[model samples]
Target: MSCASEQTSKNPMYTISKVTQSQLTDKDIFDEELDKEITDYDIQEAAYYAQKGFRVPLKSSIILAQSGAQVPDAYMQAALSNYYNVSVYNGFSKNKSSSNRRKDKEQQVNNNYMKLLRLIAAKGGQNTIIVYWGTIEKGDLDDKTNIVKWSQYEGGKLSSKTKALRYLLKFTLVDVTTGNWSSYSPVNIEIDYVPPKIGSSITDALQIDELMKKSYDNAALLLSEKYKDKTK
Candidate 1:
């Protein structure tokens, strides 16, 4: 796992994609090749959008998951699947009778999510979206389900009133033995929203002032009518 910076504004990032497996032969070479291909895709995508009069600003750093202790196999596996562009399971069944290692694996994923949440929360934007993607190598592991986890804060939950953000499902993988990083499976994360009950309403002092003015105006008008005959 990677160390998180103090400020998210210092490094705000949204990943495009990653490779799914790290066990592939010539992994380093494969990474290079994928880099080129991904770059081309990004360029072409940008050009296509530009042709359509869309303004897509590319300004985000690469965000890697990190841990202070020895990383668990589950976390590493998820990363590898993401790196190599494969599928990930949306949910992992908790094994109550499993070894301590299994519990640690589950904890690792949660920890990474918390870290990302903190980073995004620290950002200055009123509406900031963060995407957490996971996947397993195609036929490499028994669990072939594509996992694309994303943040669903209470502020963003959808109901009869509001709509949640939009995102694409994606992942990458890593090798446990060789510590090799794989290519990235691309996913998309997009969100546009306004929080409920945002901005300030009328202040108490302002409200009081308004009421006083109305009362004074009514009193003055009443007195003018009452004294009309005397004045004339």
Candidate 2:
């Protein structure tokens, strides 16, 4: 019986275990690739509308959704209210579960986004929705150099050797009427100073608030350029 058991173990089912481990390791990369593809598709769809000279009506109200770590609604409203009637929708919250299959996860996100759009339409009679989110990444020495150059261009000063953090603000505009959407990253803010040695939490909060304001302002300008309102 012992010999027979040893022989069976030699041909044990390692393939299933190995395949599962491989998948676990590659899940993140797979999700990132799929996200990039989805973003590209959104941009292409927006471009198609642009080619056809589509313009969002200035009079129609636009609903806003902030995916994570809520940036104050006032920031976006202040940035874009001048161009269009805009309001922030606080009813939607993101689903934050990790998934083994990225495509299914992507589909779930899309469904949630569309559901929010429909909700806004039903509740407020709004036909357009703009969803925004942000990500923070540690920056390298090379990024510091670029920050210094940008500061110099803007007549501001930044230390070339200071550690930096990159803040990426990504946003999308969807016209619910046609289910047409466009996405953009109008500005990437790299800051040399964050989490001050004293009062780190408060200071970090303030810094993020300021950066969010700047990002939204920049995005508003870009959106205005890309989706020009038809002149009456």
Candidate 3:
């Protein structure tokens, strides 16, 4: 409830700033950095709440967004801070004939997906959620339909019909090593179903803090509803 700095240093993974809540909430001094800090807290708390009853690997779930040999540290850090499992792999793509570039790209994607599948199997199937970094066709699970693309929540534009304040986490569950994937679901943190405020549009950062606050509240509510029975 507060952002004030505390003297608790023995426990690691502490990112909450030591500044007082008043200092953090002062609008006059508010900056983009503060906005990000608050948003991160919300995300972490929401993710933490969501994982309460469900079985998840805190550090074994791998997020491979692309074919890159190395995933940036920022992504990994975000995953860790948000209580997500973190694992990764790299594979080589063969050169393709110009006529079949599309086919080759598809093949590369499939290969990466398969490699991830094998990794999940080897990891003992810790109920991993593969957070892929690409878009999936609607209701199309057979093709590359898992692991959300960057366009979903990331600066990407949303359709008018889907215009509402939400925090989305795209994931596909692999409960077992079946050498196939289940359907990917975008977890929309629906908060009260309120219309978007005119002051803040999703694309713009005019009211980013307010938007994130609403999102956090909604996510917490949804997670609570999901695990209510388990908690009891």
Candidate 4:
């Protein structure tokens, strides 16, 4: 109703300052310097979060994302903050999307899946001689096409038509001891892969494959060396 309000209503430039204000304060500052602040928070929180939870502010997410690697402190810090949950730092009106929460979901499924695999391995090891599992296939476990069941049995509770436990970790164990190693004749080890629907987008699939290939190829070298003496 006032002159400035009327002018703002008619002119886009008048309202542009509001957008600038939104970015600079009370929101995740995307500016390079603000990103640095976020990274510092992330690293400090990550080192402590196992002992402290929500106390880690939204800014600390940088550490959460990058703590998986071992690298120089500066690069680790930068990577930790490089990508973030874009949804948490901004207000609801400004959020328009929620990537942060989605990332947590994906991580939850993957972590639980890995746990389940370890459980299976433990069971196999305990019951008797280690039971060799063949390959894992992604999606639709036997008669259960319902992904919710898959996710739940896999230790999750999210049910969406568009997501899945899309990553699989697979490897075969080999015995490399000599004559005693003959007792350790090499054997291929494997885990079934059921790539989750949400996590297995083409890009993710490629990354998973790359990891698996590298591991399997390295594993093969050990097996090959073990069998070489026998063949000769």
- The most accurate candidate by TM-score is 2
After superposition, which runs of candidate 3 have C-alpha atoms over 4 Å from their true positions?
1-61, 64-84, 88-112, 120-129, 132-169, 184-187, 190-203, 206-232
In candidate 2, the residue pairs with backbone N, CA or C atoms under 3 Å apart (3 or more residues apart, or in different chains) clash, namely: none
Worst 10 residues of 1 by lDDT: 8-17
| Cα lDDT, all candidates | 0.27, 0.51, 0.33, 0.26
TM-score of 3: 0.31
Write one digit per residue (lDDT tens) for candidate 2, span 19-72. 222111112111233444467877787677767764666656777655532232
For 131-153, candidate 3 gives per-residue lDDT tens digits of 32222111111235543222333
lDDT of each residue in 1-232, candidate 4, tens digit only: 0111111121222222222332212121111233234677665654564342121122211111101111111221222232221111111122222333564573222222122323333443311111011121223333455432332122222222423333222222211111010112233333344334655563434433443344334433443343332322
Q: What TM-score do all the candidates reach, one by one?
A: 0.18, 0.53, 0.31, 0.18
- How would you order the candidates by TM-score, starting with the best? 2, 3, 1, 4
* Alpha-carbon shift of residue 114 in model 2 (angstroms): 1.0
For all candidates, the clash counts are: 43, 0, 4, 18
Give per-residue lDDT, candidate 3, residue 207: 30
Candidate 1 Cα misplacement greater than 4 A, ranges: 10-29, 32-162, 167-169, 176-232
Clashing pairs in 3: 5-18, 62-87, 132-147, 134-149
